[model samples]
Target: MTLLRGLVLLSLCLASGQSAGDQPAPAGSQNAPCPLLSVNDPVQRDRLLYHTCYLSQPTDLGDWRQITPAQLPAQLKWQASNGEQLAFPRSQLEYWIRLNLKNDGPTPGFWYLALDYAPVDYVSFTLHRANGSSVIETGDQRPFDARGIDYRYYLVPISLNAGEAATLYLRLSSQGALNLPLSLLTPDELVAQSNTLTLTHGLFYGALIIFALFNLLLFISSGTRYYFFNAFYMASLGLFLFAMGGFAYQHLWPGSPWLANTAVPLSMALCALAINLFGRSFLQVRRQSPLTSRLMTAQTGIACGLLVLALALPYNHAIAIITVAALALICSLFFIGVIRWRQGHSHAKWYVLSWSLMVLGTLTYALAAFGYIPDFLQQEMIMQSAIGGQVLLLNYAIVQRWRDMQKRLWLAENRAKMRLEREVAERTTQLQDAMRDLEAANQRLEALSTRDSLTGLHNRRYLDGRLTELIREAHRHLRPLALVVLDADHFKRINDHYGHAVGDLCLRHIADELKHAVHRPQDVVARFGGEEFALLLPDTDLAGAQRVTNQFLQRLASCPAGQREGLHIPLTLSAGVALLQADETQAQLFERADSALYRAKAGGRNQLVVAGNTPAPVGTATNRNRE
Candidate 1:
């Protein structure tokens, strides 16, 4: 690289002919004789003379003169190698030139002459009118050229007339100097070249900056690492383009030569890294699918190779690095499509088409840059086609990616809504089941409140309520109503002797005996208290009640007291009977029956007591008897 730079510097120094301090003169030089003529006629003659003098430098060194129309007849005797004598009519001549020049060296500078003519004469010179307007002649000489020799040449402004001939001399002073040709340009062409370069570069850079900003905004809005990578990639591509020796940087930042050089490799490296990272994220290459992983590895290798090449070569290698990177990017896009296809990503088709168009554009640019096409074709046609197509493809890719993201977001939202609804439905079902269980438990609690738990019989609350209706019915019909209260004797003793299990059995036996002894449907048997029971008879007299109580007593006496492994013990029950009295409340009747039960207990155990024809007092003992 240092050798190349030194060689370039040597070439520049040799061509410039100085140590950069001297200004070289412009390339051409010319000499010619003066003429006498009306300035107006000479202007027309000189205009034609300059038209041919612009072609080349010739070898003859003298015999160049400008003449007026009056001298045209005498000058017509001159003949040369072509065997053609100069001829002029007296009225046709205005101005003319006889010229000779040495073509031994390079083309010479511009020369001019003012000439007059009379009558008729015609003179011609060879010079090309490169650019600018031709005007009528005046007395003063203007710049022109007599053309010949190997190097390039041009004609400056010169004038001639109709009645005279002008003689101009052309000289050659240097070799290999080319003229700054402007033969093809018009006024509008000159203006366009001067102005459009800046405007074109401005628009290019402006578009690049806008695209970079758009990617940056996407990165910030989405918080996706891929978007960030794309942003960096685009920015680096913009910087790389600016760093290249293009009209954009030439017109916009011409003074920043150091920045220009640094941007080359730096942007190359950054772009390579950005593209590598973007590929990894965009293709989900780390998911360990074999083909995707292999493709990613290959892309990484290519990117690394590009970086190494950029670092090792001269800075101008930025162009090669960018080209290689573009190729790698194209390949990566293809592999991404493959991965997406394998993974069942529906949007890959659009992405693939978009990148394919971009790759085509990039390949076109690459071909043009390498001089595979004409300069006019590359600059005016291929470049525009490539850039325009690539931009459209990039926009298409952006829209496709946006639509894919929107679809993913919509699916995620739908899934979340479904999950929430499912949870709500499940909770509602659970609440309904819980309410049903609670209602069942409430019904069980109500049943337990009125019934006896131990023997499954009506409790004291039932007995008390039924006894009142029995007494009222008996009083209305003047019939008999009777009550019997019974107790299991020696129940606590049974519990102490054989455990509470046998004591519970003893109570159950006594309850069974009492239920069996009550034969009437109107009679209700109930557990009155811990070891006590009651029987109410709605249509029975006191005698009938006494007889039923005695029967219950006998049945209890016959029941087994306890059973332990099939061994039996004797168990007995005691009872008291009462007849319903007129004007007596049910509580009074129950008190009398309770008193009779105690009397039976007092007269020895396992016996029945009947209420006698005595006033039923609260604490009086009734008649007692053993059954």
Candidate 2:
């Protein structure tokens, strides 16, 4: 088991391309003095001082320390070969030595001074130290450009005993200025470059906050899980980037170096979690092909393994593994997005493009970190370009998603409108059909109420309507209007002598005679009831009405019904005629006509009577000679 574990550790170290050792020097050389001075320049030669410098002041004397400086010669002379050193007793403080070089050459040339320290064992190198401090150191080492050349530096702070001795090497050469050219930088340029990284980190965090708030609002409004996942993933990615770049340690909690050291593993874990969640949301990885899902799972597992390795290894090894794993994870995400795009998910196309750009930027930075690219191309400018491109691509993808959602919503709204219109049209058509049917039913009811079924003549309701109209016309046009009321004499005796069917035939015959008597189109004849009928005439005087009524009675008396059981029966009618008064309604006109009818019946069964002009009922004896 031990051997297997060793092999696994070795494999991880090899995979990450990191050295496993933590101690800077070899074994059995624990007390050897640190060499701080070296000379490689020929243009200038001087003896430079080597000492443990203290930068603490009297602001707070409890955490302060002091140290003395020592000098060495330009060359390794016999007397100056024994190097000098100085140290301070305090443990947690930041200090640096000011190495003074005397120029031996006549012309001013470049000289190099280097300060070296062991790997950091504590959280931070504070200019002042306190017990409850929050300062921490991130294991991010990079070359700094002072003016025109690069200067390699370390920020790790350490303390030595009161009499500890260390050697310093001084090198003076014309090429030294080409390597460390702090004197060449303008003050503005120095400040700008110094805080460029810090500003970039701040902008990244600000973007993360904006994206998180935006997605949080979306989640609240739409209740979609995708927005939730995007918020979490974006926030995690921002934190991981901040931690990996060591900006979190530099400005946030500079006192806790142990916390800074843990950033690598913690960032890796968050990165893994972010990828896992993003895959599920953006790619729908679980529902994709089984092989593809397995591949995604494997990638997620690799990210998890990287975090575990970071925790188990030293700081340097952890950082190396995290960087390599981040690259691998980015590559995997890019390819997965490409695959989804090919499978007809158009949404994945934007994701693929975004990831491709990110992968290119990551590879560029990786090449720069591994010394495969030039320092100038790998510095602040390139870093900004890469990160800026990624942010722009992500913004474009978000905009594209928004546009697609809007289009879908518009289409759904249009479809609903068309569906509602169709439903309304159908309902309107049904209502129109129902209205037509109701009109037809009302006409049938009117016909049944106003027409006689036996003779097909207008019934009593028809007489009532026409009489009122005739009376109105008489008043309006100053013309005479007359109404005649008639009855079939002995209609009940006819129904008893012959069957009621024959009696109905006799009434029908009397109705035909009354219609024939009325020759003017303005006259109307109707069956008022059983054996009774009415005639209305407009523009007809009382004499004309009396003539028409007497003719109707004679015609009815002469009408013969052919043999019923070899017997013939004669039909006769009694009628009464009246002129409409100026102010008379149809009801009053009918009453006057009916009173004349009663007088006609009293004189004899077959006779005609004229209202208002008749002294007594005139018998039909006058019209009987003409028939």
Candidate 3:
């Protein structure tokens, strides 16, 4: 099928070539002198080629024979140029150009006829002089080593003696656009032109190489697929540009004309693939808009198909397919950029701008090729400049994307940190509250352990601890401290007669009486155990201690237990009081008070006795007086 198509396409080209060949010259232009080109010692810089050349195409499609220069005046019909490059559609048609030159100076004329367009398959120059005629032929179809001058374009050397007039014949044939833009240049002008073209190409290709390497480095360092895709795009695009400008043929694969003819289509196909990959990755279309992603993927398949066809098919057919695919690819990518931009992709705007310039440049060159517009700038130059701008702009876009990604990552980390801090702060507050509650519970437990359950007074444990503290304080300050120990006069009898419940009531009454008698903040009153009680007084001497003990006994005698409840149960307390002496321990003082309480019980049970035999009166119900 592919071969059949190639054959049909070749037939069409030949048909078109034949039709163009039959086009008539402008009226009365036949027999007119070939436009005369006057050359001086130095060629005029501003004399355009269109002003001096006449073009002619053979009318015989079947006549494959070459014309001789001697036969030219009668056999060929020349048409004046329209003052611009003569453009025709893609064809393998032959075009003949005639130029009449006159050297108008004493010095010989040395000129170079330059064909700036690069893809011409074959070009032949025949110089007809008065003495003889010579021909030089060279083009991309020939090896680069075969050229007389080592240059990318076809340059044919022309010379004339002073005042000599001659006619030159040029024959060109190509399978692509036959846009003949011919120029005559002296050696100096050609050098200057070469310099200008070199600088322009250097800057354009340099920017592309730089962008490719920069993105490739980014991909290597970061492992980002987007950077890799961008690098691939730039590299492929650069290759396409090089092949399009004929640099690949001139410098890269000069001996392989097959490779040279296939290079443009192959590079273009690769560029298409790269564009799809880069567009999809850059726009994040897969994640953001799946449909758009699928469209780009389909375009990628088309590019792959183009690649296969470029290798398998002939150059003209492959190039025709590549051209249509490239147009569709560029327009589709531009629309994808617009779609992604609308969907809020960050780099989409840059994508759109880059493709917009590319589309403009492409259309400009295409229009000039089809004769819709004048070729103001060389089509290659316009396209190269546009692509250069696109590369730089997209590089900026990639950098911007990197910065934006960094900013987003930083913001996410900061937000996570703030959330963690808030959690920590809340947990800290909760822990502090829990600690306070625990402390309070511990204090309650301590209180429970140290209080008398029945009497609600400090128990013997508390009395012992307080006595030790007060004794130490007294020794340190040389202040007197007092200890009193007392017991219910007949606690056992009360428990036996009225039951243990009433006995508990009586003990509570006695505790109340003791509390009333000792009204100092520094006094410690406690149930000493069983029915015994003790009082700890700080800063109280022997006399003061005796007085407090006596008063407590009297109060106990007056307020008998069960009186409020109408039960006649009498209650009294017998106590022993001891003052803290110099160098006395709490154990010794407690033993002395306990011995004094035993004496009081022995002396008839209702009296107060002090330690060291200091005795108080018995407060019996009969006498109720002190002894």
Question: Which candidate number maximizes lDDT?
Answer: 3
Models 1 onward score TM values of 0.38, 0.42, 0.62
Off by over 4 Å in 3: 1-33, 41-45, 50-75, 369-373, 414-627
Using TM-score as the measure, which candidate wins? 3
What C-alpha lDDT, on a 0 to 100 scale, does residue 275 get in candidate 2? 61
Ranking by lDDT: 3, 2, 1
TM-score of 1: 0.38
Candidate 1 lDDT over residue span 110-214, tens digit each: 223312111011123333222322323211011111121111112223432223333342222111111111122223433465376557656766776677677
lDDT of 3: 0.74
| lDDT, model 2, position 445 | 64
Worst 10 residues of 2 by lDDT: 172-181
Query: Cα RMSD to native, each candidate?
Result: 31.9, 26.7, 24.5
For residues 110-140, what per-residue lDDT tens digits would candidate 3 score against the true structure? 8898876666777778888899988887766
Candidate 3, run of 10 with poorest lDDT: 617-626
Candidate that beats the other on lDDT, 1 or 3, i.e. the better one = 3
* Clashes per model (N, Cα, C within 3 A): 67, 22, 1
Q: How accurate locally is residue 413 in candidate 3, as Cα lDDT from 0 to 100? A: 100
Tell how far residue 371 is off in model 1, in angstroms.
Answer: 2.3
Residue 353, candidate 1: C-alpha displacement in angstroms:
2.8
Per-residue lDDT for 412 in model 3? 100
